[model samples]
Target: MVEHSGGHVVPFTLVASAAQAGQRTDRFLADAIGTASRSRVKALMQAGSVRRNGTVLRDAADPVRPGQCYSVEFPPAVAARPQGEAIALSILHEDDSLIVLDKPPGLVVHPAPGNQAGTLVNALIGHCGDDLPGIGGERRPGIVHRLDKDTSGLMVVAKTEAALAALSADFAARRIERSYLGLCWGMLTPAAGAIEGAIGRDPRDRKRMAVVARGGKPALTHYRTLEILHGAVSLVACRLATGRTHQIRVHLSHQGHPLLGDPVYLRRVPGPARLLDDATRRAALDFPRQALHAQSLGFTHPATGAFIRFSSEPPADFHALKAQITANSGSA
Candidate 1:
């Protein structure tokens, strides 16, 4: 008998026989499950979906014992390919090899567990039709990079395999130019400097990123303050030296000046909030999402080998937020 666990949508128990004893856990499970491959069983084991008795089993090479009961849980399958949607896109440039666009706030980049439709990928498929070549896989065709759902900015999508390979290589080599505009709480000291840290998932909170001393990838951000509004918020321009998930947000927050309206990092009302008037403070506090935008992107054209760059002003909401904050200072 095996100990009971919860939250498994599809689960089945398999008992090891004397003949199967001493065999590798993953191999035995793969043979018993029949439908799942050895690699798939290993993946499931790694994901903590495989359990022996009551404890989660992760090591695929662990030897099985006779009469031991193993429980395997299978997650629900998702659509093989995302359906195209007729969502509008702000196209900046288009060519045979690539398409550059200004992504607005709240547009997800790819289809995921919670977001299976109405994404930028679906819109691209509709707009490009048969011209959109599958870059990495069927799931996120031609997607070389991504912007967060709430971060508005310029993005480049590869249209062909060659372009995808080249652009991906360029991004990996840090040859691609990327810059962002972020409004953060408080007047950042020195006004211009670089922030360097290694970023990884926060151990305390898996859903958020944090600067960790170990098991983290190196990240760097160079920034200069463009404006200081009412001594409370500062509009800053940031250039990326290395791309990492939430690199700018994590780095800036680690520096004690998280971006304004960042739901994940800005957990409380900043001390600088007192600098603003009542209405301005309320408006700034009520701002919905992070005040960060990918303002510019530059990279060499994969087909033509020509360097091209594109830039966009911050969206109207960003402008309005800044204006509201700066109104007291007569700098709107």
Candidate 2:
């Protein structure tokens, strides 16, 4: 049977009949649920949303037992279409074909289940109105690339179908230039080098990305140490040769130089923290989000076929954190 309460699909119990015994649990649940697909049931099972006798069940291939009770909990549904909101924007360039803006930290670029409103998509819808082209769907924007919500950076949004097509092609062809500045916990041994790995979802932690040996997309990053502060942290510049979700963070972390204040990757206090004074250590530790900024972006203008580049300095908070570290470092 199905039950709903408080806008959530409450865990509903289902009993497998004798005829349904020995079926794959996912198949059985999918057939019994009626609305959810086998894939959906499998996903829920992987997420531990499906349980048998109150114990979480993760193996979708487990055989169903006759009269065994299973429970499934589905998360709340999100809005299909994001609505426009009058949020502020830091536009750098705007024209009929595209818009370039310095996206601030904490501003989500897309609407997702947890972040349904006040995203860059919502802001763009409000700013451009009907001028925004419907690229893949009415609900999506003409975003050819993306930045993590907490990673402030310059982003280009297409305003027309032609621009969207051209820019998407440019990104796919590796014709775009993107660079970032970040503060990491340790000095790079060589001061400059390249990181190449295949990035994919972490099997151990589904919500995070990792440099995996298999079933991942190849990603490369070139980096140089711009400065080393307190001999404890390094200010680094990175250039992306390929874009993958959390590629920079994952690659750097794999080298044991995880960006400071990266919640997902920086799980423990870096050993270099001991080199800093108490206050400097506190400043680094207190940083609320990843200390990375998209400093520069260059691309061929879709409508004009001219190379266009935009640059932005790190935000005030980023600079302030650096200043605090330097001040405590006793350096000139």
Candidate 3:
């Protein structure tokens, strides 16, 4: 019988496998777990879970050997609650129960293997000194939701155990409202529409997510065009009915209007000839990362049960990109 030792151990007995004989072990393992992301797979390898013939495989890039039986044990994740740092933060709201923050782009929410320090969690630890009422056995002190490193946005962090539980329940029940602003590659038609697609890890590349027809979680995103920039790009506002991993990025890309500057989803920049003009093309290229910003969040106060909301404007980078595009359109 094939020894796919299940549960915490992601083990596999390889014989008739298509993993390239010279491919990196991490990549091969990512391919093996069709629904797992490569970063996550790499993390598993780093945690000493990957094994080759009962030996711990330390190197992620170690080549796969044909016909070799390999096994992986996924250790239960331990959130290394980061040490407090003096990093500055833009606070929107703070009370005994929760703290709302306007997180800057490039600030990671929590610590993992490669991103060890200088995260928003570190700053929160400093700001909220010793008030963490711990959640879920892991050390992620009050963290409930996450925003990607490059996606600037607003987030709420829980302060006490009771608050954490209440906020978590709210999110799980879909009571929280999230709104985002995004710039995409083309002129998305109909002015407004809803995208209902299932999102899961891409079968071809585990490092990214995609809209898959099968074996994925249901996701819904509603979008309306806020503005059309030069007829080659658009500024869109999105509301999430269901939040799934990389849901907006995957759905928009699946719609053939991948977010501008999205490295993973955009794949290739729009050809210059396809764009409205040179300035618009350059605007697309110069925009550094996926142009996504979490603009607003609304929910009932975990403690008081009163509805409250907070809004934040885009940062300097986002504003400058929009200004340049708007200006260049007139010249063209």
Off by over 4 Å in 2: 1-78, 329-332
Model 3 CA lDDT for position 74: 56
Per-residue error (Å), model 1, residue 259 = 0.9
The TM-scores, one per candidate, come to: 0.77, 0.79, 0.75
For model 2, how does the per-residue alpha-carbon lDDT over 94-199 read when each residue is reduced to its tens digit? 9998999999999988887678888999999999885563655666777878999899989999988888899989898899999999999988888999999999
Error of 2 at 319 (Å): 0.7
Model 3's TM-score against the true structure: 0.75
Candidate 1, 1-332: lDDT as tens digits: 22334743758788899999999999999889888899999998989999998799999999998998899988766668877779999999998889999999999999997798899999998998855636677888999888989999999999889999999999999999999999999877889999988999999999999999999999999999999887789999999999999989998999989998888999888988888888888888888988999999999999999999999999999999998887864322
Q: What is the number of backbone collisions in each predicted candidate, taken in the order shown? A: 0, 0, 1
Model 2 steric clash total: 0
Better of 2 and 3 by lDDT: 2
Off by over 4 Å in 3: 1-80, 136-138, 271-273, 329-332
In model 3, how large is the Cα lDDT of residue 51? 77
Query: What ranking emerges by TM-score with the best candidate at the front?
Result: 2, 1, 3
